[model samples]
Target: MGFVPSQDADKIADTVEPLAERLSEVLGVDIQAQVLVDYTGLVEG
Candidate 1:
C-alpha cells in the first residue's frame, strides 16, 4: 500500500494490527502479517 505522508503508515498499522490479532486468536494460530506503506510519489512523464 501507498500513502502520501509517512505518518499514514503508523495509522494503517494501528488499524490493522488488532484485526490481525483477532483473526489469529480465532484461528488459533500465529498469523504472520505485515502492513507496509510506501511514502513515495508516483509520477508519469
Candidate 2:
C-alpha cells in the first residue's frame, strides 16, 4: 500500500482502515499508522 493523503473530500476512514490489518500480517507485527502525523523520531522495534 501507499501513503494516503491526510485530508480527502470523501470520508477516508473506510479506505485506510483495512491497511493496518493487512500490514500487520505482512510485517509480522502489530502495525498501526495515521496520515500526516508528526512521527519525527520514532523507531521500530
Worst 10 residues of 1 by lDDT: 36-45
lDDT of 2 at 24: 90
**Top-scoring candidate (lDDT):** 1
**Shift of residue 8 alpha carbon in model 2, Å:** 4.7
TM-score of each: 0.56, 0.44
lDDT of 1: 0.57
Model 1 earns a TM-score of 0.56
Screening candidate 1 with a backbone cut-off below 3 angstroms (N, C-alpha, C), the clashing residue pairs are none
Candidate 2 residue lDDT tens string, 1-45: 333455771345456668878989998998665443223422221
Clash counts for the predictions, in order? 0, 0
